[model samples]
Target: MNNSFSPRTGSPQAGSQQVGSQQVGRLYGVGVGPGDPELMTVKAIRTIAACPVVAYFCKRGTKGHARRIASDAITAEHEELPMVYPVTVELPPDHPDYGRQIEAFFDESAERIAVHLAAGRSVAALNEGDPFFYGSFMHLFLRLASRFPTEVIPGVTSMVSSASLLPRPLMLRDDVLSVIPGTLDEESLVRTLRHTDAAVVMKLGQNLPKVRRAIAAAGLADRAWYVERASMAEQRVLPFAEAPDTAPYFSQIVIPGEGKRG
Candidate 1:
């Protein structure tokens, strides 16, 4: 695989367009929702069903969570394009090499998808959760949206799904909610948590221990609820203090805001 950033240029197409003798196709960034297939929106399902090619990002050895969630809508006739990652958590995200490698990989992926588009084959890029929210599909969208006719279909995010499973409202009355990533430095995490009335800390795999400490230090641990793989079959929900030592990447800690009436 070539690790170079080389983007091909083309005229954007709304529907099928006749670029000379060839017809160009539209691009769809379809959010497949979090975990459960039922959570997928009607528009998302319709888009996936209409497209001739389906694309998804995944780890080298996996079929991709997004593809799995959208499986019921996909048929055998759809051309699958699995954009495998070059590296996943092998190096620190702060490392320069990590950025360079990921950028190159995204560039290559965009080009690959562009090939299908230029050939007049409509491509549906499947994304887990909301495509605009921490979805890998964003990378491809940035590279391809301007050069192709594009539409982004929204879906249920894991954060909202977890909140529903908890059967708890995120914020009420005038309360504020902050969404934080567990990957932040411990001090930064603690600082952010202290100022927020309600919060959801995501990306808690190896950073579980650190995130727990930060939440505790912020005096929010007692209010936090730990949910693993929310909306999935293997789901587990527990109090923050009762949570296990290790957590999956899909796990999160949600601290609901204190309700108040004005």
Candidate 2:
């Protein structure tokens, strides 16, 4: 039941004759955008629809969200490779070997994906949001780029999606934009917010209190907006003054006018 992945090894056999004649297989890192299937870009849809095989990252025992987003665009003839990420915090702390075990999983996944690429089959690996924005697809990209012909297709990112759901613009004319991870330490967060025009703090699940203090210290508390599950049916957007005691993992805090100082 433990989910894990290992780097792929060796190349896949050449695909059908017609594809083989093309002489080169392509690896596509396709971004599927946020949770909505309709939000996918035209380029991303076209690349995935044409590829012979489609790959996606998923933990064991769960359906692949990215695949579902692009399901309508894919044909039954394509292949699905679900690279698993088995590392979960639920495992006992004393397991000791968990870290190494997880690393091996990624290695194996990369290797498995490489096989399909070696063949003349173009592989489209689906990603949630933009491929490069905190997505696991980056790991596969790093593994396969040097070994094969790879292309990255950008998609709408969660930050942008979240901002769009809000009534106010994320940034107005001449406003600075600062994107900070909530995981930053108190000092770092405060320093980063001091001179920014507008700010977005991502990954606010457990760091809400710290981030709130930093915003208060920077004197930008009133300008903040808290948004959770943006663009989805369960979305919630509230001003900083009315935000809950804790924010969800998918939540973000935005300060639209803070950029005027810079």
Candidate 3:
């Protein structure tokens, strides 16, 4: 692999000089925020501006939400790496092929980013929410962190964004809040909902119907709120029962806690 790299020029050009005897580029896992570009943290913006190479994950034929959110910071002078996924929600998560394909994709992605780090070019991987909280950046961080100087800048999460748009607090004093994924089996979802004082169900795309059934089964459908694209231009807030049969990947259901306080 070529260890020589230049600061800019689209790709790694001719540059033999290293910063030190064995200098590697720094890695930054930057969370751009839930949906609104304004939600991005100041540090995230600064870091994206400073990085020579800006990396982000995207589906085929898409600019990606994270990349779009940080478009202002990414200038023509920066090298942009768009890591496209081999598959996304096409196959069941439990399928053996799904795991194999996704694992290979992550492996290839890590190597691609590793090339930049090896060439002494600082690369910032853009994440939509907190890097460690169900963010794709965690996969890259796991593979490249020990190999380079790394920093993770947190951003506001979708849960927080949805909560802010709600009429009541997501959780009140002494209220236990559970963050559950709508992908859970119906029985599991119902059981979890029955036990938690409050909850936020994420990943509600094709699972919306199943999640709705679970909410009803748990007897919380009346209190549940369905929020779509929270804090974005297309945001929609409605009661869970009124929600349509479908929901986007960006949508979620919020069940606020009712703990009383003086």
Report the lDDT tens digits of candidate 1 across residue range 1-262. 3623222223322346564577878788888888989999888888887888999999888999998999999999899999999878698878989999999999999999999999888899999899898887889989998787677777898998888877569888877788998889999999999887789999888899999999989998789999999889999989988988889878899999897554
lDDT string, candidate 3, 147-203, tens digits: 666777888999999988888999888889999988889999999999988899999
Ordered list by lDDT, greatest first: 3, 1, 2
Measured against the true structure, the TM-scores of the candidates, in listed sequence, are 0.89, 0.83, 0.89
Runs of candidate 3 with Cα error greater than 4 angstroms are: 1-21, 89-94, 260-262
Candidate 2 achieves a global lDDT of 0.79
Q: For residues 1-262, could you state the per-residue lDDT of candidate 2 as single tens digits?
A: 3323211232222242232344557777889987778899988888887788888887778657788778888888888888767876556424877877777877898888877766667788899888888877888888778777666788998898888876678888788888999989999999999978888998887789999999999998887889887766788988887878788666899887523433
Q: Which ten residues in a row have the lowest lDDT in candidate 3?
A: 8-17
lDDT to native, each model: 0.86, 0.79, 0.86
